[model samples]
Target: MRTILYLMILGLGMSCSNTSKKNDGIEMDSEIKDTVTTESLSTSRMEADLKKKGYQTFSYKAGDTTYLMQQYYMVFLKSGPERSQDSTEAAELQKQHLAHLTRLYEEGYTSLTGPMGDDGDLRGIVVFNTATQKEADSLANLDPMVKAGRLVVEVHPWWVAKGGKLK
Candidate 1:
């Protein structure tokens, strides 16, 4: 019976891992966050080298470059203790900002990018279908992190697979 109880508790914990968020004035909590930083100097060099193999790289904007194997949005968020600011106001601000992101996710914007900050703050990345820079910019406007000064959004184009042109 004890073993069964432990198993039940473990299952409950896993099931409750789903994060909750608020959109505009609506609250939601169904999206599990994904945090992966796919950008590194080695990754960048590999991406650049891929172009030489006839894999084309294109700019989402006139000067912007996307180096990921696929397209995604990077997002960052920060709070008081992790931010080392001792500012409750900052924490409150971040919550409201995350709420905005919750709204976007609710609206079906799933490709995400980032480990939001330099330290213990919540950070993660999500990948999705390719979107234009203009589209990204529009997303930025609605993004809670961006609005809260907790995130910076960049539209990066990338190849969908090894040895393939950026889609």
Candidate 2:
């Protein structure tokens, strides 16, 4: 069951991207510029920047278009062995967990996160934009729920096209 869930999440994670939503009939630009740089970067420059930050990336030409693929960490939050916390403690931990994830998103470390719909051992998923698996793992472990042993993380390296979006 765990393996199947992991595979399903992995597939979804690979398809997920930081995409722009359409407003009415207008199409919004999907490319997200770096706030620190405050300017749009060329393909080569972007590649260089990602490399400088220890990110794994590659580019390939698909007919007339070029696609840039980047490595990201997908963390599966599963039910931990220690689930004996009281209701109040569990609630507090849940709040803290959300706050932690929000901070990570604001800090540009997490790309996406949310709870699973089914009541399974797989509780949630967090896609991290960190360069290394170790960094992602460390950040995930910092979550209050994980620290409290209510949740544990299983991380995998996933790849996606830069600025790709769900259709």
Candidate 3:
């Protein structure tokens, strides 16, 4: 979907890091480590921070690589049964919905959000970086569109690599 693609592009843009120098024919791990350390917290420190914030997280091993998997809540916004609002009211609700999403992003509660390309029952998605599904659901339900019955939300737990980025 276009929404998914848009979120992927946004994520890739945000994840760009400083380029590191190569040593001879190989890239030095230390250089990579240093870059990561400078841009954000170290893995152990990040894990500790997440724990302190009550976020669910775990370390995953795949062959020689280890990844930090963090739990997030994905809220699927669907078309609601109540669609009889006038154009003016609907437009106002849409504006309020966008403002709500912006607030969540600014508050560090959402990582990604966008509408789908099609006009099906599934309207959009919001990836909430909350500690619990209840919190995510509560926040999503606060959206003006949802409150006005223009949209409804179904939330589910999703796990993602802490710093994984799309290429």
Candidate 4:
């Protein structure tokens, strides 16, 4: 009687374990299907949105590779902590710096300019609508911040969509 009881318990435990494994496999399959469905939905939505925006699918791409539409200048701003005499001077220089940037924008020299968030060593970036690095460098040096030694700029050539023209 004892041997029979032990065999019955072992069989019952094995059956339960097999059922649990089957349920887990079913759950995993469901999760995989959900993930695939979500990814396909996201991809289709992105393609539709791009079409709605009047952008041609192949305009910036060559097969699987993407290419720049035009060449422009990118200026990276770096902090110059030792250049300021005091806080007031730094503030004043910053004010002048903004004005200088506005002037450049109005003159069609700077296409875009913005400050980076307080996260890294990069202070800001200025995009210039120029074909050569020398011209961009000269223009960037005109900023009051650069003149006051409160900031320094490094210029590089960047190529992107020609559609990125400033209004």
- All predictions: root-mean-square deviation over Cα? 19.6, 15.4, 10.1, 15.0
Best by lDDT: 3
Our model 4 lands, by Cα RMSD against the true structure, at 15.0
CA lDDT of every candidate: 0.50, 0.87, 0.88, 0.73
lDDT of 2 by residue, 1-167 (tens): 99999999998785454444576643323333343223323665887899998999998776435577899999999999999999999999989999999999999999989999999999999999999999999999999999989999999999998888869
Residue 65, candidate 2: C-alpha displacement in angstroms? 1.0
For TM-score, candidate 3 versus 4, the one ahead is 3
lDDT of 1 by residue, 82-132 (tens): 233347866776677667666666676644434534555445444433245
Ranking by TM-score, best first?
2, 3, 4, 1
Off by over 4 Å in 1: 1-86, 112-130, 161-167
In candidate 3, what are the lDDT values of residues 89-162, reduced to their tens digit? 99999999999999999999999999999989999999999999999999999999999999999999999998
Question: Which residue runs does candidate 2 get wrong by more than 4 Å?
Answer: 1-41
TM-score of each: 0.37, 0.75, 0.75, 0.56
Worst lDDT window (10 residues) for model 3?
17-26
Error of 1 at 1 (Å): 22
The number of clashing residue pairs in each candidate reads 11, 0, 0, 0
Write down the TM-score for model 1: 0.37
- Candidate structures ordered by lDDT, highest first: 3, 2, 4, 1
* Residues forming the 10-long window of minimal summed lDDT in candidate 1: 30-39
Q: Residue 63 lDDT in model 2? A: 45
